[model samples]
Target chain A: MNTQVLSGKPLAALIQQRAQDEARVLENSGRHPVLAVVVATDDESTLWYVRSIERAAERLGIGCRIVDLGSEATEQVLASVLRDLSAEPSVNGIILQTPLPVGVKADSLVGLIAPEKDIDGANPLSLGRLAVGQHAFAPATAQAVVELLDHFDVPVAGRNVTVVGRSAVVGKPLALLLLERDATVTICHSKSGPLERHTQPADVVVVAAGRTGLLKGSHLSPETVVVDVGTNVLPDGSLVGDVDEASVTGVAAGLTPVPGGVGSVTTALLLLHTVEAARQQEPAQLAAAASAARI
Target chain B: MNTQVLSGKPLAALIQQRAQDEARVLENSGRHPVLAVVVATDDESTLWYVRSIERAAERLGIGCRIVDLGSEATEQVLASVLRDLSAEPSVNGIILQTPLPVGVKADSLVGLIAPEKDIDGANPLSLGRLAVGQHAFAPATAQAVVELLDHFDVPVAGRNVTVVGRSAVVGKPLALLLLERDATVTICHSKSGPLERHTQPADVVVVAAGRTGLLKGSHLSPETVVVDVGTNVLPDGSLVGDVDEASVTGVAAGLTPVPGGVGSVTTALLLLHTVEAARQQEPAQLAAAASAARI
Candidate 1:
């Protein structure tokens, strides 16, 4: 590949090391970083993700609990379960997996999570805090993007950064995070006229527009660090990204690979948040979940 | 001026016209946009601002009322007042002016205002809504930025826009608004490193950072539109903007003047929200308020 692949492994490892250090500090202080993840059903993907969290917590010496509510969980049951987790002294971070069965709206549950406990930063309150530059749980994936950029020694300060997409989950927060880093950021979405025109001038091009291969090299600067967050399954059962791999590699200087880039770092980032939440809540919570798990 | 200016005069007229159209529909439906502005011992400037709101409401055919509280207002007293206003049907929007006594926290009072009447969009919940792309009130000054941009036929879509500042009242919400309009938005604040570098590449630069002459000709592209939201008074008793006039008029394609730009549009937007809140509230509440006023 002509384009240098921006490896996330080392950056994710750095984040993991910090989490481990935090976990140790918590343990020394008789406080532990605790994360409670709720999965409503036995989807294969959810199982894998939950396992990743569980193992990461083990490796970092942090507390991670998996709560399975089953497929038929109602919103009331889910909220009640979340409330219990929120109130538990041992639980510092909470992660609710998506695809919460049919008829259960994810939007309604977003507001239900306490902003502090929202490790994934999906709560509207957390999001609002993010917008206002207040004390907030930075959305993990978006935070990871910045972390990865920093790890690569890419200077966001005074860079022209263009972000494609405005989904609350990734694009919007990512753009804000970049802005906070002093990069002049422009966010493009479906409504943005002439997407390529915006993309080509940026020093950093981050495509989280959801559509597979929506961005090509034609839209990028020569040495732009391209971060692609799209994970689309091609007809051939292959994973594709928002940036057309063939085109970007030849034209761009550095690019993040689809599967091993942002996606791989997500679970690790969650682990980091779990540890952060543990450290924050250690004074007030953590032991309660320990006892609850025992029961 | 070489720098671009987003003059608010044209934009204010446009937004007011829209607000007027909504007012007619609301009144025809037996609903009137009613605003309840409460203040504790208003300072001169504060009094002037209130008067401006009254005039704007009167001009728009929107109903307006005031709760001029004494300086010795307590949190309990204000909370009780807000609670009554929230319960009152006629009060569509609730605006609490400042000079808040030292002990009183402005944030604490937000919970007391009903979401429907939170026209100032000061409530954290409402601000959070804007962050998450949910339907909520955008702060007056921030919304005015977009309204002004749109009125001037600014091609916000796919443009690189930078907002300098992150104050809840202006910078933060303005960034969100730009993102909504499909602009690639980057936000730079005090902590933002090498912040001026980002401004040079921006198609549109919005300087809400209050420090006079914070933005200048060297920090901008000759084609950039400079919207200065700063309202500062100079030693010579002259109004000033964040951008140094000597530097900006020679660089930016367009720019907003300090006195006549963003500061002018904010009140009109507040009135618009009040009218909207009035239209949304039940008629029984306003009639009750009308009765109370008569007594």
Candidate 2:
């Protein structure tokens, strides 16, 4: 059986080019799009991820502000920072990064993010808006999965798509996105009994469980298109997905590689979302800029 | 197979009693819980439903203010009315009745009902908050389904629960509530192909499709528990649910009767939610009232 690799690089590049073009247009209009990433942790991987976002933003000509409050940041401090960022007209998007300090609850702080500036859709308002079929930026990772599926020409409408994990960032949001697309979405979590029961009958299986090798060939049918959204670091300092790549390679009709799949597209989408936010926030500014350019 | 009837009357009575007790206490303390019902249209059924709510509120000693904007109300009028009700210090709960005027979209007006006053959970923010497992009121009908299941001693944890219909008010919200209780929920809609494919294997099936007899005997396994949320009115002025009760009675393990099931509990829950919202909104007011009464 020939296995198809649903790579995210081509899609990510396409999105990145679009973001770059939009960012340049906004910049020419004297309205530079900026993404404010609020980080309260000193975790190595988290810092690495933030740096990658900065590099990506730089490449796209979008301003990336890394508001590192350090490891000892309190929830009060975090909340205040988010509130200020939300009110900051210069900041087009706001992302409260994970792995907060000991007492800082993400749920408590996420609400402080203004919905217009919520590029990653961390705000509950964004989630609710998405669920009710309203226009809101979905979580970048969740939206990336949908974008990847579209890129691969995989039809989600009327298809059985099983989403593994129930995290707010990925699974839950992804399920809402799929449901909007008219897909029969089943969300499986730790409490959900065997993974195979849900995955085997699915037309497309999305693994975002974060546990390495959580999904294998045995869990899916030969016709299943598997999307691995997990990026787990192995003991050998290598990144792998929730799916056991070797086991599901030929058995599954199609599979998305971890590092080169959802992750790449997520970063690209964040930049695009920032650009979009900028455009939405200052449409009059863009119009004025366009008129000035004509003059 | 002899099937058990899951009656919501007992649970509705319990909730009503609780709401009455709370309302009495709140009223004594100078903070009377008031639910404002904003009606826009002359839809007979919608008005009847609103009147029933008013009667229920009266019976519970909770204040029900019917703010009828009449049939010719514009979206602007509806939005302003909702905003005024939301801002009214005496108003603890707000419900915008459906079958609104021709051009008035419920979605646009629902957001105007502040989350604190959104007893019915019509606000997208409320839904979003519920989705993230945050502190928010679940839509009463959705919450009623869970409460009824609990009263009947139906365990949803780690069970296969298929929800038919994907409306924001009932099916979607109910699915989220069930998911929170650790049920592996599958939301089946019109696009989900054949309904039996999703329903027949479920440990529990909740039908909220608004289509009479949407689920029949063949749509379920013998061991399945069914909760009918539909309230379709027949041409003869008879009320029926989405489930064909006669067809499913002997086949399913348990079934909730149409009029005596989710509807009764939903009204009771709405009143309860209003009292609870009142308590939450004016803790200081209640505290002050308690002190005054003590004096």
Candidate 3:
């Protein structure tokens, strides 16, 4: 079977357009959507990701504030910043960029991000709300996988989806999202013995384990649609995903590329979430924005 | 295959003993562990369940407070009561019983329960904390499933576990608990067409769908161990589980009995949680209680 490449560029562009259009309506109603990206580390790759988000926010007509606290930042400092950002009426969304300095735990600080402004769904409250089928923002990366699958017209309801990994950010949340969509989801991790035992039987396989080339052709059936959520930076500075592209290409019916797959769509979704947060935070502005859209 | 009955009586007895011993120590320190059960409905079955809990608490030497708000209780009144209970220093654990009054959503009221006293884990914050592997109480029914399995020496890590339900109270939280134990867990619901498709491949199957005879012998392999979490009341006023015990008995390797299985363990776990909550809430009293235990 010839495998089809599920590129995320088209989906990203479509989402970016939606966000841009919504931002214009909000701006016309005198409400500007602002996203706060809190960075506590000077990691090169992390900085690059943050810059990309800023550029995307600018293009979408959303305000972007980069709060860069140096590597010597303490947990108390991070907590205070998050609390202040959460309370800031001007800030519509907040994203605490990963790769925190030593001794600073992200989990402890994320709870301070109010669920309303938690665009990336970093807050534990957001996750719990998501689990119980309540209104809450799901993590953008995890939502990206679902959005990408929907864009390509892949069915999820009652379909067997095996999410390989159990991280709170991706695997666990992704599973909950899939479950919400009525898809039978199985979560496999490091201790799951052989990957093929879970992957081969799945209608769709989502690899978010962060291990480069962790899944190969032998681990899937020909009918499998694979979504590669892994973005591993190699020694040569090139990026790859958990699924081995070379071997998985012809063996799987569909495969999402590492760079062009879940990553591109994730950034776009973040902007969409920001505009959504802005609209939700200001009910009067949201009404005006809706009227403006109807026009 | 000759099936072995996994009775919860033994585990419940053991846990009750532990709670009793802990309660005795706390009492000696002049601290009494108290559990407040807030009931909004006058449902007969719910009242019966509450009375059973009261009886169990009495046996364990834990104080039980039943706050009956009647069936006409409004959301505001319920919320106010929950908030007051959350603030009460005497109340170590809070349980808001189900079948809440008409027009009263439990989700909205549960959030008012402080996480420190949310022993039943009804609050979304508690559920979120559990998902992220933070310190929080899981719903006793969900936790009982794990404890019962452990008491019977069922190996969960690296095993295939098919949970037949998607409820917040049982299936969802239980899945998280099982995932934390490194089990490759699949959650199946009504949308999942055939029960056998998901349950047959599993080493262990947990049925919590609240449907009588939802899982039959045909849904399992000869080697499968089943945990029935259902407690459905029949028209004859007799209670049965999701599993068809008569049909599943001779086919499965092991099965948890309906009345004697997960249900029994659940009430016992709640008492244990109340005592544990009391110990955590009073630090100085906890230290003294610990010393008393040493004696």
Candidate 4:
């Protein structure tokens, strides 16, 4: 059986080009799209993700501001910094990074970020809006899976899809998004009875449970489209996805690799969301300026 | 094979009595809980629902004000009326009835209602909050299914539950609520392949597809707990649920009746939410008043 690899680099480059074009338009209109990423950790993987976002921002001609609060950053200080950025008119997008200081809850802190500037969807409110099918920014990883499928021309409508996660960030919102596209969705988590029972019958399977190699080829159909959203770091400092690639290499019709697939697309989508946020804020900014001038 | 009816009337009465107790406590504290319902059409079913809410409010000692915009109300007029009711300080709860006039959309207008008074979860924002596990009033009908299950001590955590329907008000929100209770949920809609394929494997099945008798006895596992949220009227001027009562009577272990099941529980939940909304609002009102007096 021959299998096709769904690489995300080409799609990410295509999206980055579009975002660059939109960023130029906004810049020419005197509205510079800026993304402020707040990192309160010293974790290597977290830093790597932050740097990737910076690189993607440069490609899109968007301004990237990385605020490193170090490992000792208190929740109070982080909240204040986020609130200040949210009120800053120049900051079009705000992202609160992971590996936050111990005892600091991410959602409660990120919820303080202005929704209009929340490009990464770290805020729970953004997830809620996505669930309700309202206009809100979706988490980059979840959106990446959908974008990858759409770019590959995979049929999602009326298909039985199993999403292996129940996270607020990925599994839950991704299920809602898939359901919006008319896909019959089943969400399975650790508590789910048998992963094989859900995955074997699904036409498409999306694994984002963060467990390394949790899904095996035996859990899939012969030609199922598998999109792995996991980025588990191995002990040898290598990255792996939730699906066992060796077992599923020939089993899946199309599969996304851990490093070159979802990761690349996620960074690109974040910049794209930044440009989109700028576009949404433009009209409101103009209206406010006009009102001020009149006053 | 003996079927037992999951009657919602007793549960509804019990909830109403609790709401009555809470309402009296608020009244004695010099704060009256008032629910303002906006009706934009003269549809028989819509009016019947409004009248039921009014009657329930009276029983609970809660004030009910129905704002009827009649049949010819435009979208602008309806929006204005709803906005007015939403801003009224005396009104503690706000609900907009369905079967709205032509060219008027329910969600866009109802979204203007303050989330504090959004008793029925008409707004997308309220639905979003519910999705995020935040404190927000959920749509009464969706909440009733869970309430019914909890009242009956039906186990949901780690159970395989199939939910039929995907309507924003019922199926979508109900699935989220059930998921919150740790139920591994499968959401099936019109696009889903077959009803039996999903229903046959579920430990619990919730049917809210609005089609009468959509779920059959053959679809059961003999002891599956069924919560039917459909309220379809029959030719004989009687109401029937989505489940065919006769077909499932001797097959299923537990089931809920049509008129006396989810409907009664829904009305009672609405009042319960109204009282909860009043409790949430009173603290803010008092704090604001105290600050003003101090100033």
Candidate 5:
């Protein structure tokens, strides 16, 4: 098998180095880049994800604040919290946790975010920005999808890339990013007819839909490279990807494991964007103000 | 050789009915939907397009004012004109001509139009609103492309739809609109490699590269329904679509022509959007206020 794993380790390392460089620049200024991570209705998965972000932020020398809310938090309550954070002078970025129990709409929660503080890009403003070629806090997971591929020296420009799924968080944004890089991208979803027809010829396949074995070997040719973005729980309570690992290992040229694939690179990307967001907030100016106050 | 023409004449007829119905609604409310057509250069194509819009508006009893500036109009001058139109009670919609002179940026021009007043869907705010599934004036051309496919009973839902092009006016916005329809959309552009690899299997293909005959019959399978958005002028002054009309006609099941396809549907769409924009504005409220003052 000519299969190669598309790893995010290298990109994470590069981003870490850049973060340290930026930290020094921020330290020279009086202020640091702060990301306020709001966690409401704490699920096990959310806890694990939050812990990782906390560790990553510490290692990167960036400020991280975890805001907790009750599971019964109303949309207004959550929105008010976000609005307060947005108004806070010290807070440079905001990341709101999703799946805020029953009755709360993700749509309404999204509009509450100040476009400038929305580092997670849950807001439509950010999505629209990317659509029009403006600078936006692209969904970290989506950015990681491409960053991982680029780190593996996978040539995306002019390649036939088929991305599965079209959520704002991944498939949709990734398509735009791929178009920006000049890749011919085709997006397929659960509704797409004859999935094999779209997958068989793909130079690169990114499967993000949370369905197990969605892309089997029969759907891919031996030359196809697969990046599975799904982190689905199997019947046995184990993690699985959208692409069937068994079929791809023997038939496809390359495959990324479900957990180690997109999931591994995602947290680091969140931190990377956070640090970049901080740096963009003018660390030098903050440092000067602090130094002046000290005198 | 089974290409059936996706005739816009029938589609235009259908849309004209909708436009006239909307016009009746506005006329009864004692408010005519008004569109302020702002033009700087008297480019032949621009003049022709403006005339078409004027004719459509006149037929619908919608008011249109041609804001003509000299060919050498500066960005500042044009922006100021748009700003005034945005504030004016009479102007319910605004259409800014593209290919702005040397000094004016299209992005800047779009920035000036109020989201409600932006009938052309040229503004960043409008584009952002569209991405998140909000009601915005989507670019008429992009909307027409999708509307044609949907109107023809071409099922976009769950189709492996590949769009080649990512221009702000056509490609990018169209991708977002298709995604909204639950179709798995992939966007390929000039940078996309082996473009045929993406096109060959697409259930639906939309080519809007602004280059003539970019998608050939050999590039697509017989089942692919092609919507050509290109309006390139041939060396001999003939207008052609991105797809070769003769080559794919027998092979592809459905194809749209260059001049008669998207172009014909576009002016009617521009008028439709203007009427919609006018309805959204409170022209009724204005007239009522004036009448109350007179009483």
Candidate 6:
């Protein structure tokens, strides 16, 4: 098939080691990186995801705190808790876990996180900065896709990339990131007709549509590079990606597999972002101290 | 040919009248809507644009204040003036004129304006909100394009739209706006190969590339709807658009002319946005007052 499998495990381990090294330096400076994840649901999968994140962060020498706002918590309570965490100097990163309490949308509350502490790029301001080509933390999953391509030395600039999803957290932001890198990006969604028409001509295609088996062999060109961001659970309790890997394995030049791609790298990036947030706060604290001393 | 000229004059007048009506309501409520435009250079064209805005705003019974920072004004001076204007409660809208002095990029300084007071959508936060489909003031020029299309009853939902530029003010934001209306949009720029490859299949094409005569008749399929946003100055000092009007007249079903198309409509929308900002602020101010009474 000549298809190279892009595994996130090796990259995740490499990034985790780097994050651990950085965390040690911050600890030596008497500062510890902490990520506060707010969970507002009782869903098993959501809780499982939270625990995995905690374990991953701890492995990287970063502290992960889970603030479970019980299923009955109102939006106001959640907002207040987020505000308190945002104000705490020890909290380097803040993330609101998904499956938020009923009638309470995450979008309305994510803006409360201090932008610098929004390590996951959940804040609209971060996405906005990315769109305008300014300095801001990109959402980890989107950044992971780019990191995977870069690690493999794939050329992006001046290349055609068709992203087959348009969610703000993934597809839209990813398109902007690619655009900033000087790649010609086309964002297609459910409304975009004839998926093959868009994907066939692209040098690289990113499939983030939640639907499993959305991209078949017919949708890709012989040498197309594919990144599958979908992690759909099959009826048998196993995971299948958006692309039917069996069908496209022979057609595509490079592909990121379902289990060993995107998700693992996303976790590693979150820890790295936590460490990064802690590092950025050092200078700001020093500046504040300097101003106080002058007074 | 059956070429239909989509003049902005009729639309501008209609919107201007609506703006004037709204301005009277705000004035009657003891809150006169005001727009403060900050000019930082002595370029004749820039000054001419400022005067045009001032006259348009006044015609709509909106107060216009020109804050001239002079040609020698530094970035610090420009930022300070914009901050002051933003903080003024009566100044419902704040706009920064183009041709900023050397070393002062507009993007870097526009963030100083408060989002609520940024009627011209200079702030990145507003654009970010728009990206996420949240309520935020869109850039006047971008909104004008959509407003013109809607006024003519050109359906956008499920239509294929090709936007020929990616500037934050026009092309990029317009693409996002069109996306919000359920149109499948492809944003093409200098790097995108063969303009016709993108435009020919699009039900509508919006040309915003500043290059004169960028889109000719050859670029179109029969009966394509074209919106020309270019305002390039010809060698003879006359203004033209990105499209070659003579070449496309016979081939296109609808087209917007250069000098009288987007520019005039953009001016009217700026005033309309000023009124909208004033209207939005009233409720927030009332809430603050009501809370203060309880305190």
Q: Tell how far residue A159 is off in model 5, in angstroms.
A: 1.2
lDDT (Cα, 0-100) at A256 in candidate 6 = 95
Q: Which structure is stronger by lDDT: 5 or 6?
A: 6
Tens-digit lDDT track of model 2 for A213-244: 99989898897999999988887878999999
Can you write out model 5's per-residue Cα lDDT over B9-106, one digit (the tens) per residue?
Answer: 78887787788889889889787788898888868877877888888788878888998886889988898898777777777888888657876777
Consecutive 10-residue window with the lowest summed lDDT within model 6 chain B:
B286-295
For B59-161, candidate 3 gives per-residue lDDT tens digits of 8899999999999999999988987777667788999998988778998889988898899898998898999999999999999999999999999999999
- Per-candidate clash tally: 25, 0, 0, 0, 11, 0
Instruction: Candidate 5: list runs displaced more than 4 Å.
Output: A234-238, A282-295, B1-3, B87-89, B182-186, B193-196, B234-238, B281-295
For every prediction, compared with the true complex, DockQ reads 0.39, 0.72, 0.72, 0.58, 0.58, 0.55
What is the lDDT for B10 in model 4? Answer: 94
lDDT of each: 0.79, 0.90, 0.92, 0.87, 0.79, 0.87
The TM-score obtained by model 4 is 0.92
How many Å off is the CA of B134 in candidate 5? Answer: 3.0
Q: Pick the candidate with the highest lDDT.
A: 3
Candidate 2 CAPRI category: medium
Better of 1 and 3 by lDDT: 3
| Candidate 5 chain A weakest lDDT stretch, 10 residues | A286-295
TM-score per model over all chains: 0.78, 0.95, 0.96, 0.92, 0.89, 0.94
Q: Which window of ten consecutive residues has the lowest lDDT sum in model 4 chain A?
A: A286-295
Superposition-based RMSD of candidate 6 using all C-alpha atoms, in angstroms: 3.1
lDDT of 4 by residue, B171-213 (tens): 8888888888888888989988778888988889999999988
- The true-versus-predicted C-alpha distance at residue A235 of model 4, in Å, is 2.8
Q: Model 3 chain A — which ten-residue stretch has the worst lDDT?
A: A286-295
Name the regions of candidate 2 deviating beyond 4 angstroms. Answer: A283-295, B283-295
Ranking by lDDT: 3, 2, 6, 4, 5, 1
